[model samples]
Target: MNAAEIARDVSARRVSAAEVTAATLARVQAVDGDVGAYLTLLGEIARSSAARVDERIAAGEHLALAGVPIALKDNMCLEGARTTCASKILEHWIAPYTATAVARLLEAGAIPIGKANCDEFAMGSSCENSALGVTRNPYDLARVPGGSSGGSAAAVAAGEAAIGLGSDTGGSIREPAAFCNLVGFKPTYGRVSRYGLIAFASSLDQIGPLARSVEDAALAYDIMAGYDPMDATSLDRPVERTADSLRADLAGLRVGIVREFDTKALGERSDALYREAYRDLERLGAELVDVSLPTADYGLATYYLIAPAECSSNLARFDGVRYGLRVEGADVRAMYDNTRAAGFGPEVKRRILIGTHALSSGYYDAYYVRAQKARTLIARDFERAFAQCDLIACPAASCPAFVFAAKSDPYSMYLMDYYTIPMSLAGLPALSVPCGWTVPEGGNLPLPIGLQLCAPLFGEKLLLGAAAAYERATNHALAHPAQIGTVPA
Candidate 1:
């Protein structure tokens, strides 16, 4: 069941929260071994939380997400749960407090089933970077389910959870959603509080949701987004009810099509899928208008500099003096070096080196400062484009999910986020919905393709509503992986 149905059924006393929780847990236990979506399962906490929901239901309280089982990306702190971010550096580190987003989920009566695995410190484009384990795509175990929110997306796609909360910085959530054939929403920066979220790139990281349908994503977003005094970057604006804004008609909405996106950069099949998406939107009453975002071409370059620099600064706190793994050495400097070398994965180390160098004395202006300027240009481009259209349409990625190790080089893997990083750079709201499916050569199962719809800052209601319209017109959201109902023997 979707979160809405679960909440309604639980509130109407048709099914107890405990029963729903048990079923969800059973589903995970039966299939998680093959999917490897979770690093830890909060079975006891889930049951206790479900009991609380039942009690609230009995008292006539209408919780928004009553009894809905959800999975949290390991990067978000849930007090007493191990928030490892799928990195060995903090493998056993337990969070001392819950993230503001998570606190909201609990208040709305959503049960967290476990900490979903992710790329170590949310650094890579594939779950292969995870020190914990590789999370296989449900559609094809040999292929990747995108990253750093791959596990969260996979859990939702495989029906292990009703919804999954993920953090997006440079397409972490959206790319994974595209790969897993699920709906992923990334709110404008500061729209959601980041108080207890483990920082990857502080400015770029935003908490969002991955779900089987657009409405489910919107429902979760509504409950999680709002002003939080605890998070200084949190927007002070009034919270909007996105779920109520869902509509099945586009009518006069003008959707912008990025001219750069229609070029030969995408694969033949992917380009065909993108064209089909344009037709699908037009059929649903949307007016497609050509638009240009010249600066978007530099998004990947700009993000690499800014994100790594921020990550280098934020991750500095994990030094041996504070918490996490600590290795002994001859002196303090040696100890710090030894601990970091042993704790961080290859990708994390590479980024740290690049970031530290970029922020170093002589190169700051050449790298970091220049990147910030490019970021502003990207934002300005969006502002201008939004004036011409209500939302922008593009492919979620250049291609569909690739087989594991398809991108052995880091640079090639970075290009996987080409279609997604621009919006993150602009701090805008973007949603990825399953538009269609494509079967790769020699591949038996069809892989899902995602269509990304982006809106200007604070335009989530419009963004989600349009996605809902497309979803209603074409029931692509109803498609699920063949492995969703089965466990590998």
Candidate 2:
């Protein structure tokens, strides 16, 4: 059952909060060994929270998300919870304060089942970079569950949690959601607070939800999203009611298809899938028009430079002098170098070095400044495109879920996110909905594909409503991963 259905069943007294929480916990225990979704399991805390929810329900008290079991991405802080970003550098660090999102969910009576694993510092596109272990795709154990929000996506797909929270700087949230055949929503930059989230690229990072359906995702978003005084970048926006916005009335919804996203940019199969998705949207009363976004052509190049430059600065705090693992050396500087060298994974080190080089005084203007200019143009492109259309439709990523070994080459891995990085640069609201799957028969691996819907800044209402409508039309939201014993039949 979806999150809405589960919450309704509990509220109507058809099921108890304890019962649902137990089922969710049991499911996580049963399938998590193979899925590798969670970095920390909060069994005792979940049960205690479930009991409180049940008590409130029994007393006829109102609760927005009472008894709903959800998983949090490791990057989000939860007071007293072991919040590791799947990095050995801070493997033993426990959060002393909770993130606004996690705190809000708890206040709404939601039970946090655990913290899901993620790429170290939420840096990689594949969970393979995690210090804990890779989070396998629910559809096929050998394939990757997209990252750096891989575990959050896998947890929702495997039914270990009703919903999960994930962060997106590039396609971290949407890519994983596409891979796992779930709904992932990335709100406009600053639409959600980043005060307690482990920083990756502070300028572009945002927190959102991943769930079985768009409505569930939106519901979670409404609860967790809002301005937090602690976060300087957070926007002071009121929480708009999204559950009531899910309607199938797309009478004048103008949808644009970026001409830049041609077959040449994406491979043959991906292009075909996108064409089919456009047709599907057209059938749903959306007018699909070709729009030019020249800046999108340089999305990858700009992202690589900007993201790493920011990462290098943000990561300078971890010097083995304070929190997490430390190594003694000949001196303080040597100690800092030795600790970082030993603690960070290879991929993390690579990005840090790239960022450091880009930010160096002599090279800053050539790399960082150029990337920033490109980013400005990219954002302006979206602004121009939005004036021509109410929404934009495209493939969520360049391709479907790839094989475990397919992304061993860094360039190939980087290219996989080509279609996704643009929206992040623009800092707009985007949603990824499961369109269909590739390798549909004869093999255990079913490659899930997603159709992305993007809207102008702070236009989540339009983006999420469109996704929910598409979801209801195709019944993709009801589809669960096969072979996962925890998934509902």
Candidate 3:
């Protein structure tokens, strides 16, 4: 069952939170070995939390997420869980407090199943950067589930969790959701609080959900989107309930198809799939129009600079004197150097180096300031595009779930987020909904592909409304493609 149904049934006493938690735990145990979606299991905490939820229900309290199981991307802290961001830096460090988002989930009666694995420090495009364990795509174990939210996506797709929390810093959430055949939603910047989420990039990182459906994603977003004094970046505005208010169709709405984002360049299959997705929108009453984001090509370069610079600044807190893994040195300076070198993965080191150099005195304005200027331009491009169209549609990524080790070179891997970074830079609400499947020439299993949809700032209401309409109309994820080789695609 999805989160909404689970909550309904549990709240009505048709099922107990304990039962749901138990089954979820069982499923995690049954499949997690092969899938490796969870870095640390919270079965004990989940059972206790479930019991409390059931007691609350017995006392005549209705909970928004009664008995619903969730997987948290390891970066978000949960008191009892080791909130490792799949990095050795905090490998076994227990969280001192529950994240505001997580605390809210508990209050709503959601069960914390486990902390899902991710790229170390949430830094890589694929889960391969993880120091703890690798999370494979549920559909095909040989393929990646996309990163750094791969574990969260894999957990949801593998049925280990009803919904998974993922942090999006330039499509970490959406890409994985696309690869895993789930719906991933990244709220507009500050729409969701960042409290207790280990910072990746302060400006770019936003915590959202990777769910099985748009309704579920909206449900989670509705619950999580609000002000938190704990997070200065959190918006102070009141959030409307999006789950109930989803529009039936895209009547009187305008959806933009970007002029520069050519899906045809991705190849015949990917191009055809996204084209059908656009047609699906048109069929749902959306007026498809042409729009252009002229600065979009610079999104990746801008993100690499800005995100890493922020990462470099934010990560400075992990000195040898403080928490997490630390190696001893002759003196304080040497200790700091030793700890970082031993703790961080190669990918993290690479970003730190890039970021440090960008932020350094000599190159500060030349690179960092220039990137911020470029970022503003990207946002403006979106603003111009939005003036012409209510929303913009594009491919979530250049391709679907690729085989492990497919992108060995850093530059090639950086290209993975080419389609996703611009929306993030604009700080706009966006989502990737499953649209179709593709079986690469040598691949036996059909990999999932996503159609990315973006909305104006704080325009989540319209964003999700149109997405729900299109999702219902297409249900592309539900049907598999025709047989490509030996098995039905």
Candidate 4:
């Protein structure tokens, strides 16, 4: 069920919050063994939290997300709760303070059932990089749920959580959501505070919601998003008000299709899905226009350089002397080397080395600085496109979820996020909504497809409205995976 439906039922006394929470915990217990979706399941705490929300509702208090059960990505801080980012490095760690987003959700009466798994430090595109183990896709257990927000999307897809909080740097949230057939919304960069989120690529990261439905995603977005005094990059404008202000009518909405996105780069199956999605949109009374963002050709290369460069600096803090895993040596330097070598997974170490090399003094201007300039030009390309159109529509990824074992080369795996990453660099509001599914013969691969919608910065309302309309037309969110529902959870 969606958050709004749960809230309505809870408020109407149709069900107790404790019951829902218990069922969710039960679901997690049943499926998480195979999925690896959650890092820490806070059973008693979640039940207690739900009971309190029920108490508040019985006491005649009004709350937006009352009795809605949600999960947190392991990367986001929760006071006194373990926040590991699915890394062994922080196996013994717990946050002394809660993130502003988590605090807001708690205040709005949302129940956090557990901490979801993620790629260590949110570095990899697939959850396979997580120190915790790969988060299997709900649709097909043999395949991976795309990451680093893979666990959050997987939990929601498996109906273990009504909503989940995930941090998107590059395509973490959106790609996973697409793989799992859920709605993933990433607001304009800085629209949500990054203060307590374990930084990945600092500038590109933003906390957003994953839900089974578009409206549910928007509702959660409204609650957790806003300016916070603690974050330097936080925008002062109100995200809730901006989202609420979105128009429902599509009559004058200009939807741009980046002609470049529909190509061989997306592969045959994915390109066909995009074409089908556009045809469906055309039938929905929306006008489609072709547009170009030529510089987007290098989005993958640019993102790899910029995100890792930033992550290299941000992650330098966890070198044995800081909050993460510590190894002892005769001196601090050896301790640092030992700790990192042992603590970091292969993927994290690879990115760090690549980032360090890119940012080194002699190479900075050529690789790092040039990438930033290219990023600026790409942003401008979007600006030029937006001037001619109110929104842009495309596929969320080049392909649907691939077999987990099939991914070998790091660069090839990274190419999956190519379509979605450019928007992150531009700091625009982008959402991935399920378009349909492809039932491939002889492969048990009933993969989900996502249609991506992007709008100007802080234009969530427009994107949400479009997504909501498309959702109604398609009814994809209401569809559930076979044998997965409120069976136990």
TM for every model, in the order presented, reads 0.98, 0.97, 0.98, 0.96
Error of 1 at 375 (Å): 0.8
| Candidate 3 error regions (>4 Å) | 480-489
Residues 333-376, candidate 1, lDDT per residue (tens digit)? Answer: 99999999999999999899899999999999999999999999
lDDT of 3: 0.91
Per-residue alpha-carbon lDDT of candidate 4 for residues 270-334, written as tens digits (9 for 90 to 100): 66777777766666777888889999988889999999899899889888876968988888888
Residue-wise C-alpha lDDT for candidate 3, range 218-253, written one tens digit per residue: 988888889999999999987878898787899899
For candidate 2, what is the lDDT? 0.86
Residue 401 accuracy (lDDT) in model 2? 69
> What clash count goes with each model?
0, 0, 0, 1
Ranking by lDDT: 3, 1, 2, 4
lDDT of 4 at 14: 88
- What would the per-residue lDDT of candidate 2 be over residues 345-460, giving only the tens digit for each residue? 98889889999999998999999999999999999998899889999998887676666777888778888678789999989999899987677434555578888889998888
Q: After superposition, how far is residue 394 of candidate 3 from its true place, in Å?
A: 0.5
Each prediction's whole-model lDDT (CA)? 0.90, 0.86, 0.91, 0.84
